[model samples]
Target: MIEHQLIVSILLIVAICLLLMVSHRIKVAYPVMLVLGGIALSFVPGMPRLRIHPDVIFLVFLPPILYEAAAANSWKELWHWRRIIGSFAFIVVFITALVVGYIANTFIPGFSVALGFLIGGIVSPPDAVSAAAIMKFVKVPRRVSAILEGESLFNDASSLIIVKFALIAIGTGQFVWHQAAASFVWMVIGGAGVGVLLSYVIIKLYKWLPMDENIDTMFSIISPYLMYICAETVEASGVLSVVSGGLYFSYRRILIIGFSSRLRAENVWNFLIFLLNGLAFLFIGLDLPEIMAGLKADGVNLWTATAYGLLITGALVIIRMGAAFSAVFVTRFMSKFITVADSRSQGMAGPLVLGWTGMRGVVSLAAALAIPLYIPGTQTPFPERSMMLYITFVVITLTLVFQGLTLPVLLKWVKFPNYDDHLPPEETERIIRIGMAQASLDFLQRNNKCADVKRSALLNSLVTHWNEQLESEGLATLYDDELRKNYHNILNEQRLWLNKLNNENERVDEEIVRHFIHRIDLEEECLLKE
Candidate 1:
């Protein structure tokens, strides 16, 4: 039976991967495809169903997802939009929880207000994965993407913290307002502190240890988990620990790590994230059968659960839209009273897009599952645990399908302004590489011995190339229109000659030829970027 289940799980993953590949070609968001595919597979005959323990998703999936999102965010942009992002992540999340919790309490029979709040918190924060994936083809403005990414980075901490306290209040039958507030402060501070401290330790290890790049990459993967575990052990927020630790490493990445390590780390983390995300979303679909069975066992039918789910999901969407609109006026108003930079100057369209982008995913599912089965101080199960899970799943599916599908239309309707004033990416790269090449020349002349004739010739050739690029670009020497053309011809000739030698010379090993060709290809790419 176990082996059969294992084979089923592997097949499920393979199916999800194939779905992702097909979805990519068709331009459908991957998470949306995964959820839809999972739902479709749930009813398959002879399918081996796998159960997800509440703790499994929380422990296995949440840390790296949060860490990668936070680490990849641009610190400068994140800080610049901190106020706006804070409003969405912290204030908007709190409000959505309250609104949705109230609706669930009033409408869903036997659902306690505390439990409603818990459910509310679960679905509050938007998952950026879908929105970001869609944006790759949709061409939303930079500011819009920045705000979305920034909100995603910190919102998990806020929503999860709310869930934490709500669970405590429900379990203990006592809710202290002051204690809750204080605990939040402590979690934020303590988690961030631990994350920073741990990040420094990891960075120092990278500098001090003489480990291989692959080993260093292994440690890099473990660092976020270390931060999370350490913070949770101290009763701090593991979510914040992962976020801050990721950000710290990202900010200091260049100073502490070498190029080869960076390359390996990038590739490793990309693949890891893809796998983790695929599994997390696939689990969401795969877990549906169990959640439905639990509901049935509790004497609640599918229709009743769906109705409550719609009510709660509607409340979440309405409240978030209201908050998004209010934020624009509020930010503008507060900017006059306070001296903080105004992030709302992009006007109404940006906020509307922000409001519309709140599609929840794995975090919501994980948080709902993380709810303990039995309430403390009683043999009875946690109040509305199954109902809450069902409702959370409904919200996730609806948003991912409805909102995620229509996001591109919304972007087109908004007609957000483009950033035409900035230099093209290739042009920017060309300009930067010109300076870099000159710096390389200076460093070679100052630090290295060029006594060997061949070595000296190479150094001189490199300096001449850099100088020619600078002059062609009109930075230092006179701008010659033909210098760029002449340089292009020279590079083209070098590539042709190298290719011919590789094909004609019997002594040239294919591996050595390919390596040199790769280097030349990189240089040629840089030259062409402008």
Candidate 2:
């Protein structure tokens, strides 16, 4: 059995890699491709039905993914769009859940309001992974991306909290509004508090401890899990904990770690997220057969569940569009009374794009799967579990595939308003490069007394380079083939010299030599890219 499981895992990995390659070649979103591939694979005769544990998704896959996403976002941008993000994440999600609940309760026979909310919460939050993957294939404004990213981060917490309360109301056969509301507030505040506290400790540990870059990277890998588990232990929102801690750590990364650690951590996190996200969407496809089978066994009509799914999905999109346009108006109104980054009432393109980008993925599935198999302390099955699962799966598939594919076409169709106030990307990069060059020159000049003749010559060369960078309008383009060739040759020679030194010297550590080689490689890469 174990060997069979191992073979299946290996095959799934191979399949995901192939699907991703195909997605890239064909210009389709990888998540969409992966899901379609997983579905195709599931129908093969004798293929094992894999059931994903909710704990595995929540504990193993979630923390790092959320942390990475949160950390990648610019806190400055998130803050500037806080109002929009807050409305979408909290108000929009709540309203959508209520709408879904109302629809489910009204349409589905014997489906209680609490059960309606259970499914609502399950499907409320749009998956950042899905939206981000789709966005990669389309060109959208930076602000739209920021708002979506920020909304995804917070909405997960809010939606899950709704799930929690709904579950409580179901299990105990009671719904206390005041207690649930108070508990929600505590969970959010407490979760954020836990995250902040853990981040402080982790930051201090990085600063005060004697550790290498590998160890620094390891701490980063562990920090999210620590924050998540700690917060969840207190019955708080683990999502909030990871996000808050991630944001805090991201803001303080330059102070906490060296360049090597940052580079290594970035690469490691990127690969980790890719693998996890790929497997997640693929699993959703794989679970389809089982979900359908459950629905059949429970005597539920497939068409009925699908119709409900479609209805809920349509309602979600409409609600999101309404909320988005309303947010623009609200922002304009609020700007009149208070300071805002941009007060202009932008056109419908931004709101329309934002509205259309709501795609559900792993988080919704995990929440649905997390539902208890039976009512608490009873043999009775949870109300409409199979139906809800089917509906959630339907929503995920339709939104991820339909919206994901259509988004690029929509972007091309909509005429986005251009902002003259903000600097162009190239101009921003140039200004930043100039500032960095000037700072480097100032630092070297201030420390000139510490350099010997050999070091001073190197400093002089660096000084000239920095001056050139400052004067250049853009990145220093490597237009001269001879200079590029000479740079490559020098790098190779340096590597050979380092190898010779390593072979001859017993005092110098091998790791230190490898570090220098890595630095040379980085330099060569930068030069070639220039």
Candidate 3:
């Protein structure tokens, strides 16, 4: 059975990968196709059913997913908009839970108020993969993208902290709002504090050893799961540990680490994330049978579950739209603090759209499964455990399908920027080049090699070549006597025209690309001759 299961797992994974590739070619989200395939395979006669425990699901998947998203985000970019990120990640999540919870209680008749809080907790954080993957089809501002990525990372912490309050309501049959608020403060404080301290201590310890990129990379691969589990075991939010640890690494450890080490870490984390995400969607597919079976055992028939799914899904949708629009209104007040973000031309649209695109998938499903089978201090099972799982699965499927497919169109119609202007690749590249040149010149001067005229000429020419390449690529270029005497003014003017053309409300990628190449090629040919 083990051997057969391994074969099926390998083959199914392979088939899904292939489907993902095809979906990429067709411009649809890969998760959408994978889910459809999983559903189809579930009803197949004589197929071995996949029965995965939810605890195992999170343990196996979440660490890698969060790690990859964190690693891929440009730390520099994220820092520039840290204010906006904090707003959405911490502030917005708290507001969302209250808003979503209120609507769920007021509108979804027969649903427990505690469960409404649970619903709020589940839907509070936006799915990073779902939002970004779908964004490929639309044009959002750069600041918006960074904010989305940052908020998604931290919101997991907020959502899980709130989940504790709801869990207390379910398990202990007692709840206090003031205590819940106090617990949230502790959860955030404890989790972030512990994570930072642990990560800092780990850095100090790890630095004493020789730099073996592979071993360090391996450490990166496992850190999230370890930190999260440890934090959760001690009664702090595990998701908080994951995010805080990730941020700790991003801000301190990753920056100080060497490029080779960073690359090694990134590669390992990427594979880990890919496997985790793949398994997550696959499990989402596999969980259908189990959830359905549980619902049947609990007297919630499939048809009734479907109806509940639609009703709750509809309510959540309306709630998100209202919430997101409200977020836009609040942005005006936020604008007094953040001018770029306040501008309608930047990432405000992202939050507005992302506000409505709150698609609950793994986090909610995992939380549902994490519900204790035997209620603590009770003889009975956790109340309505099977029904909760059923509702979670249905809600996840509806949100992933409905929002995942349609958000791109909505964003495009709203005319978001395909690339964020504030990212300023040109400016960033220029700074890097200046630093490198300063280092190179200092090295030459220290070695007393500047007297070698042929060598100096060649070195200068090579640096010039590199600078011209930078200029051609729309990056920053350092000023030089030769460049100022010959090439700088003309090239700078052309760059100005290109920027003008871009901000002039143009669309279509091919033409802008061709224009860049035309300018670059002209510069490249000149360098070859020089």
* lDDT (CA) per prediction: 0.76, 0.81, 0.65
Winner of 2 and 3 under lDDT: 2
Writing each residue's lDDT as its tens digit, candidate 1 over 418-462 gives: 434234546544544454455444544554433421334433465
Candidate with the greatest lDDT versus the true structure: 2
Which pairs clash in model 2? none
Candidate 1 C-alpha RMSD relative to the actual structure: 9.8
Model 3 Cα lDDT, one tens digit per residue, 264-344: 565666676677777677677767887787778878777866776676667667766676566666767777776644446
Ranking by TM-score: 2, 1, 3
Runs in model 3 with CA error above 4 Å? 75-84, 99-110, 137-139, 253-255, 334-352, 417-435, 446-530
Clashes of 2: 0
Clashing pairs in 3: 139-416, 142-420
lDDT of 2 at 141: 75
Off by over 4 Å in 1: 339-345, 418-427, 441-454, 470-530
Per-residue error at 160 for model 1, in Å? 1.2
